[model samples]
Target: MGQRTTVATTFGSAVRESVGSSLAAVDAELARRYPGDAGTRQPVHTVYVPADVFTAGTVREWGDRALAALDEHAPDAEAFAAVLGLPGELAGPVHERVRAKLEREPVEDLRIDFEDGYGPRPDAEEDAAAARAARLVAEAYADGTAAPYMGVRVKCMEAAVRDRGIRTLDVFLTGLMEAGGLPGGLVLTLPKVSYPEQVVAMARLAGEFETAHGLAEGRIRFEIQIETTQAILGADGRATVARLIDAGAGRVTGLHYGTFDYSAACGVGAAHQAPDHPVADHAKAVMQVAAAGTGVRLSDGSTNVLPVGTTARVHEAWRLHHGLVRRSLARAYYQGWDMHPGHLPTRYAAVYAYYREGLERAAARLVAYTERAGGDVLDEPATARALSGHLLRGLDCGAVGTAEVTGLTGLDRAALERLAGRPAGRGF
Candidate 1:
């Protein structure tokens, strides 16, 4: 038996007590900066529809069009997989899920665009459109047909259209309130954010809205569109995106990349502009790092390449979009923008294949790590968290079945979520 000995220590509680307030300040700052994930389902993509063209049937129409494109172009699992170069084993499951997803919930997130998509209109016309958008969106949600997340993308805070944008936003939000308070899925976007002051202004604007409507403070949140060179690198050579997050005052939900606008701002020729371009990658990389632990999600920008015309042409465009989507997924950007109904097919195809192809392996590794069983590869807590996140994301988007995930990991949804560090009872 070994005798128990009193251990001698050099520094004790005195040192901790001396630095307590400083440590408390640091803890508060960390909490403000990196609040962790919101424990909610982040949509796989956002669909932008011109405010003038959106209607009650817009969502259903998009789904039908996407299904039609798939039927006409790549009708079978093998054919669709061939187009996207997916693995053999993933062909069937991915195909089935893509079809089911398109039919069940084609557009997870939709934005009524008042910016480029609905470029400058007469003041009265824009006002009317914004109000109409609110009405239709509210009705759709009431009928249980709306997307999981829906919002309006107002113009920038630039001097040219600043007042117009503010007026349109007021009209839309007021209309939503009149319709029957704001829907739970409501979102707002501030585009072409070039300065942190602009984000601060937006936060203040939202605060005013909350006050006017007698809602709780900080109830209005928005996304900032990263489109300008200055947003990535400021005049002082600092990373401006970090400041944008801080300026948001906890009202920023995401940072969405604006593909063409940003590419052109960087002096990239129109023909050479794409999400995979080096300049685009650099900007998004900066955004990814700035937003990493800030509870702010990153959404990749859209492609201008449309899948229209002949079958061969559609296939080419599909391949292009699919490859780009796969590249973004590999880089950890789970969401992007879909410009048209035709893009939806490949969007789901790419997302499904990405998650499905890696599901079993991730599940196995997660199970091993959680059970503390010896395996060929040892994974730490961080890697296990990543694995759990992968599965949860797959489940959220319908790319992976709950039953299959449970069978593989021997952990149900609640267990997996706890392992992922999400607050309990917050289902995907």
Candidate 2:
């Protein structure tokens, strides 16, 4: 109505600045919560043994026994080469390297499983077993014989067995702290999680245990097993993995796939409950999508076809197990479960072959891409990351040495380390 009304154009800038600041804060918070990858050394596989059978340095002892059996059966590098499908020229070196690794650090991760592996027992007996495990863990720590990563797998939080799970965890933690405090890099594995509430409850309980033991908050991290249908698809008919992670409140270290139970939940026949089955792939993809860039690790389930006896049938079973492990490796799941000591050879064989097969090409491509030399080759940041990750994993698992990596990539040790730590393209 007025003759000289002036519009306040400054308001838009103020609104923009305020919104930008708020968004920045939110982005910072998200980074803090998710925080990219942890850069920790993830074990290639976790070996589970029954709690009752566990003893101090049992992992080492079992590995030594397994090596003796392997020697008895395979006898020499050529014999082992036939089983691993390696060139005759590579047989002796591969055999000696694996043997030395087994002798030195046979078990990267060990799980004293109180769930399926140890079934149900009387409360008193279960408590005693938990105490024994605690004593063994402490002794392993004192003797420096503990695996680089170790944990205990408690039972599910189903209403019928929730108390048992809690009691076992409580007893184990109490005994562990009373003995010598929690071991470094120790984690708890919570199996058969079916709901976000289950994750929340477990995290809350872990927090309580830490507090009671005077340990720092978030010191007790746990891995969740995605076993049930509800675990993948929430009761609300939505994929609930992200929800589960959020419920963990930053204590979730990994999400492990449970092949058999998940297959059974989908009504798949036992004969068809396979790792690479379409349904299993779907669940793993969901987990990957949910956990990508969240710093939470992923592990595949085990192949139950154990190589037990020394017969043609046993060798066939070993071949099948090797194929399964290879398939898992191809899918970028560097970690899986090893159910029996007999699985060790195939585990290392598949892993080593995977890295070795891709080494030359991956190194060449990475070097070219890093130098910005296109040369009719198309390379993306994702490819660079994958190559770097492969090499880093190979180094971590002792499948390849630092000298080999540096030689192949033409990068010095420090550069390789920096490349491994960098976020792909930025450094490349």
Candidate 2 lDDT, tens digit per residue, 290-323? 9988889999998777777765656776688788
> Candidate 2 — which pairs collide?
none
TM-score of each model, in listed order: 0.98, 0.90
Name the runs in model 2 displaced over 4 angstroms.
1-19, 87-90, 412-414, 422-428
- Number of the top-ranking candidate, with TM-score as the measure: 1
Cα error, candidate 1, residue 87 (Å): 2.1
For candidate 1, the lDDT comes to: 0.92
Tell me the whole-model lDDT of each prediction, alpha carbons only: 0.92, 0.83
In candidate 1, stretches whose alpha carbon ends up further than 4 angstroms from where it belongs are: 1-5
The per-residue C-alpha lDDT of model 2 at residue 43 equals: 90
